[model samples]
Target: MVNQNNSAQSVEKTPSVDDKNLMNIAQYLKGVQQSHKRSIPPLDQWHPKHCGKMDLTVKANGEWWHEGQLIKRQALLDLFSSVLWKEEGKFYLKTPVEQIEIEVEDEPLLVSQVDQVDIDGKLYLQLTTTNQDVVVVDDQHPIFMRDYAGERRPYVHVRFGINALIQRHVFYHLVELGELDETEQGKAILVLKSGDLLLQLDS
Candidate 1:
């Protein structure tokens, strides 16, 4: 139930974006992360009137940097990853009281590994992110391809509005597991099937 500042005009009253402001926001988010260890913060419920853009950036390889300096603390990266909010194609670190925009060179997360699981005669694909987040590929968390550097690369929805780019080697392994299938238009495609769910790797 966190809320923004007192007035909608609070944007004019908020502190300017600076190194000190970044540090303050990071510390505040750290405390919030600790309180929500068993679950992600209620970011969708929190509303901030003005979200200012900042120099924080997540590199394509999933390295987080603040002002051109790498964030070496895995704990901070994990903490910030939890509050990542997306709006209108931009990224931000959000909290109940504040929202700070950040740059993302690619997807906010990276898929480091994947596994196939079978239960009750049903098959599923499980993905693990660099931050240790695990999600099963299903209707809600499906894989889709996007044009990256002139090539189509696969990405999977991780959580909230965040997505993880599948590492190249891992993506190759997924292609190996796929079988040839035909589209409704009778065009051949590569696909991976798990139980009743089917994903086209090549479109």
Candidate 2:
């Protein structure tokens, strides 16, 4: 009887908020990694039971928040990002058995790193997301800008129907590497990729 009582107490003991968050994230990463090894799980097709909303939120400035506290751990953030997806104009982390919604003030991703390389006598831009996933700025994937509050905000396609908002410093680097040119149709563009990709600039 005493052993049963002790076991019950152990099970009943609640973990701290931070501990709970970590456990959930760790479990999610484990499942996601296994599924990713084969291929991206068909999160869109899986009609999983809707889990309750998580307290996770991504701010406009690319900061992540959990339970109203800033999530400063990059590793945790990266793990959470691996399962991100968008549908019906909303972002979600769709695990195998549950789909949880997270708040996103802006785009769900941030391109925090940038690099330029010479490919066949032309420079190619490589952009890295917060999750360390890299995408080349090429013909199929091009950089774009939008006017936000009278300022041009830079963005680029991340992957699988998602886009990343370029960080301020990364955008500055792109500006330095970008060259102005004209297309055959006389549209002004910024030539950032080699051979083909000429990003159209809004006049």
Candidate 3:
């Protein structure tokens, strides 16, 4: 579940298009957690029929919601993430028998830490997600920027077509590690790396 921080707050909640459908998925999540024993199940192998649309959402700030209420359980989010899959440019969670679609406001994952290395004249970068999964930032998992409401934010590919937003402190660290590289078009790009792991900075 992703609960580094969890507290119940009765603030006004965001409306969901399918709250009833989403709540059922939340209850079903408990079964998945119990049966899988806290590890990720083979969601890719499971091609179950679509149960329905889940009104579950991963907010822009990384908070998760179900049925218009804060989940308040990071563990629950982590559990759902274990079976999370993306197909046809959409996101879904799969249990052994059920598959449910979820809404994601932005990227579902977040970069929580950054590490760098240099070897043999090459640089590489490693990023840690909020889920504690570590992924190397390379050509395969490239880092770039996205525009959200006219503000630019840094993002990196984690895995399975999911991008993790680089947290503020880690972004600052990456900035300090950044250097200028000439592009093929002769334009300069600000980037950081550890070996072949290249992270591009965009304005």
Which scores higher on lDDT, 1 or 2? 1
Using TM-score as the yardstick, the better of models 1 and 3 is 1
Q: What would the per-residue lDDT of candidate 3 be over residues 54-162, giving only the tens digit for each residue?
A: 7689898888887678977776677666667887888887666767788988888888899875656665788888776677776788888889767888898866777
Model 2 ranges with Cα > 4 A deviation: 1-22, 31-47, 118-122, 180-189
Note the residue pairs that clash in candidate 2: none
Model 1 per-residue lDDT at 83: 80
Model 3 collision count: 12
Residue 166, candidate 1: alpha-carbon lDDT: 93
Ranking by TM-score: 1, 2, 3
RMSD of 3: 8.0
RMSD of each: 6.8, 5.3, 8.0
Count clashing residue pairs per candidate.
Answer: 0, 0, 12
Model 1 worst lDDT run, 10 consecutive residues: 1-10
Instruction: Give model 3's TM-score versus the native structure.
Output: 0.73
User: Model 1, residue 44: displacement in angstroms?
Assistant: 0.8
